[model samples]
Target: MIHNPNNILTAGKPLEEATKVMVMVHGRGGSARDMLSLSTYINDKDFAFVAPEASQHTWYPYSFLQPLQQNEPYLSSALNVLEMLRARLQSDFNLKPSQIYWLGFSQGACLTLEFLARNPMRYGGIFGLSGGLIGPEGTSRDYAGSFEQTPVFLGCSDTDAHIPKGRVLETEAVYQRMGADVTAKLYPGFPHTINEDELKIVNSLISGQ
Candidate 1:
């Protein structure tokens, strides 16, 4: 099922009974099961979690900073998977955009931010861990639509080898321009891993506090 949306893993509350839903995306080389582990930290008992596995556990073949076309059909396919999942949640579960949230790490984070920017709306919240928007520095961000004040959090290491702090800042600016309530933080000299402080923030966001 390469690039297919059928390979999905779910946890937390059953979809029929869930009041909130969070779509979690794993990074390159990561699996749906790995992404589901985050629910342990999210600790949102009422949330229904959905995680889609990518082909070969990777979203795109090339680096996100590479020219957009270089990522080709894989990038587009990955985005489409998200679209399908969103529609599924809405139609099947009677969930609204405001009842859904998104979280991703590294490559997954890039895709998450790109999707939100391309399809702007008011979501429960968005959390990008250790990542930034896709494409090189000069990629045109002329994306249309507004987030309508959706809460977005982006956290990364200042010296991350894969994600540059500059890109993280640029992503924050872009989301802000699109009317998202964005919060971005750079941990000085930190490793390329999620930190407890970030989890705290996520819990707070999930709690709507």
Candidate 2:
């Protein structure tokens, strides 16, 4: 009779046969089903794909540019959801952080960055589309952790209405400082949507190419 705030939808091979697990987070107003839909473009049956749905189809009800505290319990809850899923994968499925990958879009991308920043590790890969760190402009990150050379790919629109390019650049710099091998690409005058080139890059990342 109780309701869970997080609902997880899974695809691909089960945890036993699949050594790789991709955690896909959806943007604000997006569902776990929508996040799982991305698997259509990516052909990989060896990897397990999991997406977590946020309550009411939103992570936090404000711009990521806002102060971190402004996002409050909702943001914390969202990150906690990811943490739970990661822990389950490590415990139940006997998977390590290095075998786990993350891919997210828009608001979900920001969430991904924040979560990884709090819990640093050598993950398989990270792809963030049109998003960046969470907090106001010039917020002092001073985060204490290292990614240990994990590969991170960031793709953003130079003219995205929601996410400014400067934040993306700042996030890339932060990732590099945290010991991540970062690759950043900005499309000029691009809308808030993924393009073929980005998809191709994602495919390569997913395929470990």
Candidate 3:
């Protein structure tokens, strides 16, 4: 198992009869509480929010731009943490895969997106803020399985110093190939941070019809 410890931050209805659950992931140097704070803007009492912190405020040791293996045991371990959370949510609250959401920012966003791609399922939705799939310049992305029509939102700056626009497009393509309903937005002159517009869209996604 990955050696990193997890700090889980929870909010809302405590998983009891909640229609939706959002697993928020923080960026490097940020805590789970930092991500969970986003729930305040969402403010949906019926939906539960959970954020799991990385052992050292960072999921992996190297840039996600490196080769998959180069990120080391941390990458695999981070994925394992998500898997464990999913299993617990399923057994404890009888939550269907379709009722769970994955949300992340920056490095956390990269991790969440890669995890969903590797373990494709019918999640309620996926919100990736300032991030894309992990890999070097020409990493092969031969993933399988459909998202079963899950909605995926990819919001990023056109000139994000940390993330390349090409990778964002590639990530969108991968999700589309997996049968996901994808909505991608590239903000002009935005920085390497989440913006209000992105939060507005996220709110709409979680409060679907």
- Model 2 misplacement above 4 A: 1-6
lDDT of each: 0.92, 0.88, 0.89
TM-scores of the candidates are: 0.98, 0.95, 0.96
Query: Which of the predicted structures, 2 or 3, would earn the higher lDDT when compared with the native?
Result: 3
Instruction: Evaluate model 1: give its lDDT.
Output: 0.92
Off by over 4 Å in 1: none
What is the TM-score of candidate 1?
A: 0.98
The number of the candidate with the highest TM-score is 1
Off by over 4 Å in 3: 1-6
- Kindly list the per-residue Cα lDDT of model 1 for residues 100-155, writing each as its tens digit: 99999999999999988999999999999998888988989999999899889999
For residues 1-209, what per-residue lDDT tens digits would candidate 2 score against the true structure?
01133489998888787889999989999988988888777766778999988888888889999888888778888988888889999998999999999998999999998899888899988999989999999899898889998889999999999999999999999999999989999999999987888878888876763
Ranking by TM-score: 1, 3, 2
C-alpha positional error of residue 140 in candidate 1 after TM-score superposition, expressed in Å: 0.7
Better of 1 and 2 by lDDT: 1
Best by lDDT: 1
